[model samples]
Target: MGHGTNLLRRGPRTAVAAVAVGALATAGLTLGPATAARAAISCEVTYTGYQWGSGSGGFTASIAVKNTGDPVTGWTLTFTFPGSQRLTQGWSAQWTQTGARVTATSPAWGGPVGAGSSFFLGFNGTWTGSNPPPTDFAINGVPCTVNQVPNPSPSATPVTTPSATPSPPPLRIVISPKSIVVPEGGTAGVQVTLSQRPPGNVIVGTGRVAGDTDLTASAPVTFTPENWDVPQTITVTAAQDGDATDGSATFDSRSSQITGSSAVLWTAVERDDDIVP
Candidate 1:
């Protein structure tokens, strides 16, 4: 179990800095507070999931935490699985589970997340009955606003923007079942679509961001204005490894034409088939 650390502890200004400010005031100059006030820790978290099989099944969960307030030297995210989702393996953080509760602590090389920056962590789990996304999320004991990304339906219509500009909605690439389980010698697919229609032909590029090098995603797929609303599938294949442990990888999808639209992240877990009884 890893614990988060914050070197910037809250306290009073140093005496030497205060004395220098006092001298400056006597010289006809004013100085502000020696230490800047620390902003409250606030965050926005997005939870996305993808599942396969029936009855007792396996799924992947991807969580994105955006530091909306102050910079976090490190962070600990805690949440509960609405269903009987037991963690099998995770990446990008130190993961632990106690019954239904799950905790993810920042890794040694994954910390010091700055304000306005976001970090991603996910896991492969098993679930029973129905799988529902968790509504409660907290970072460093502070509650976070959770945004759930819903799966896009096949009959979904294209969103039309008005000619007269009002406040434009946040642009995003829609990826359904944002996570997948790829067997060590097999592949999995995820759908990619645009939240709104593009002006012309838009190219959707896919690439691996982090995780196991043995897992590879498909090449870039293009979606034109004529079929922007239709979902396109991206394939992820896992290469066989000698180890028996499952491997995970993160892939990103971005639209070449949609300005200000951030890349959407998805995770792939390799189901190692080399384990013996």
Candidate 2:
């Protein structure tokens, strides 16, 4: 997964160097600290506001929408006028004004903003006395960072970003028949399953219980798993002594080559096997 952040794409910044100082006021967008998210779909807007003299006849505002995290399909720009500024006309997109709130939607041609790319639009507005640029901006229902002008000129260095990568699922093992009882002279079969294919060959090992005088166990002490899809069966034969009253012996079946080596250790109740069991 890519972080979607890379070399900053420069079109036209919000800062107006050509306009005489004091004659125009910048949008003064706020570039707050980056927010943490499960998937960073961060977006940002850079605005340039030109005030006509004393903001008596309203002003003209241009906005460039940028995708800082992931790619976006379309944009629905929304903002609120701080003062009595009312939108008069807009170009490059269709806009709707509701009281002091305004919304702009992308036109038929442009709206898809790829990661690290941006688009811009401008609108004219009217004011009674005071005209102030909007402090908040959201695109497509997700709030975007309001980036203020760094200075008259943007930084020359390109921002380096790290790509995102997802983690793989963990390895698992399953076995059937946690415990068992063998007849006087009978045998039982147990199934061994793997969660997924092993990184390499896997081996199974069996250990005999101590002081098992009346019971004898016969099981495929060692095994080489053929594949992940197929399950391996281990036959366990036991010898029952009539002289002894139900003598019991226990055995362990474990994978020779497993992840974390000693992470999984399972004990069968009667004659059990496998990871889950």
Candidate 3:
């Protein structure tokens, strides 16, 4: 009986030690064969496009991104156009195009995507010659499985249909070179343009919305119906400061004349001139 009791006490100690070892392994002690790593990012994407007119035509592309891996707080979708596709407008995301590559980043109101969930983004673009859809896509820098949807076949017999009234494009302020770095005590310029022609002459104002007070913007600029599409330069000047740390500011373009027009924000960073002590 005494020997049995001793064995039972030793059994508890062994079990406790085993549990301790398991805890350490769970904490990444690597006691055994390496644990399989979970992929940080994985996705599946669907792409579809619709075009109207010919030669220089306009297209609208829709993309659905399904998360197959972990949850993501934010996402950036990237692709390369096979043809000469140019982005004109986008929704649900911020879109930019450079050469053949295109990028779409999550907007402020966009929400996160959980594992096994999906989100949608799209844009309006212009193309010439051929309007071939992109074959590849990546989300958050990881390659995604792409599923391309074929364009619908035209009807053999033409049928007359009533045309609905076309809606006007949303008013927007377009700023070129949305970001810049202003040298301390120097100036940098950014061009501002209107997304669409205004009803009449529009006066756009530039002002600092937030951040360092040392950064200043030029006076208001006017955009007329004749030159609404043309870019108007807005000069940003950084005041010299004694601090050695780089300062940053947010500048916004606004207009009181254009109702429902959204303001555009741009960032400016002041280069530090003073050396750290």
Candidate 4:
């Protein structure tokens, strides 16, 4: 009886040992892949200089994405602008604007971003109001701090008194081909040439024959008119034109004049005209 009892105890102990070993093996199998996955994925993005366009009067910032982690099938970038700077255009990714915040996502390309591989995206928009770029930015939800770029100093000082020799107006403006014809509800392209370069903070106003219209650019103070109702002569004016420090005079206008379907005759008013035309 004693021997039988001892044999039964030994059998159960052996069974328990086997079960413990099996559980450890299963745990090792489960953890190994997870560790490997983490090692394989990379998440680093590099920022290059922006490629500015002529519309919306703002700069387009470019960035490169390098996958350092396990192959990334997808990712997202979120950033905020300091002050009133806003994002108006983007490519290679979908963008959403909320207040001063902007977020971009990679949805078009789903193929794995293999380890060490990279991709690129850019954002374009108007600065509208005066403000600086935000210091904080993010990649794939990771926090990043931007290096602040120094602001350029103002070049021209206000003229205290009219010189005996009056200086020519800071900017000379000309409308190219002087005219255009576009279908009603369509857009007309107008080219403006400037005798002088424009200031960094320069603002250009659009004048049309009818209806309210707004123009924008990706480069500074340049734009294309979008909404038109009828045909009419349009005059565009530049304000706060800059001098040689920023660039040379003789800058071309990206957005100066636009006409509608119905031509409205515009005559320049002269000092001699008793009645303004």
Pick the lDDT winner. 3
Work out how many backbone clashes candidate 3 has.
0
lDDT tens per residue, model 4, 140-259: 666644444443312112336655886556443445545343322233344444434434322333333332122111233342232121122233222122221111112233233322
- lDDT (tens digit, per residue) of candidate 3 on 50-158: 8775566788999999999888888999999999989999889999999999999988887878999999989999988878899879998899999988854232125
The models' CA-based lDDT, in order, is: 0.83, 0.63, 0.87, 0.49
- Candidate 3 has which clashing residue pairs, if any? none
Q: Score candidate 4 by TM-score against the native.
A: 0.37
Question: Model 2, 28-107: lDDT tens per residue?
Answer: 22222343222356778988776654426656788888889787665788888988888999987889899998999988
Q: Each candidate's TM vs. the true structure?
A: 0.43, 0.39, 0.43, 0.37
Ranking by TM-score: 3, 1, 2, 4
| TM-score of structure candidate 2 | 0.39
- Measured on C-alpha atoms, candidate 1 has an lDDT of 0.83
Q: Candidate 2: misplaced stretches above 4 Å?
A: 1-40, 149-277
Off by over 4 Å in 3: 1-39, 153-277
Better of 1 and 3 by lDDT: 3
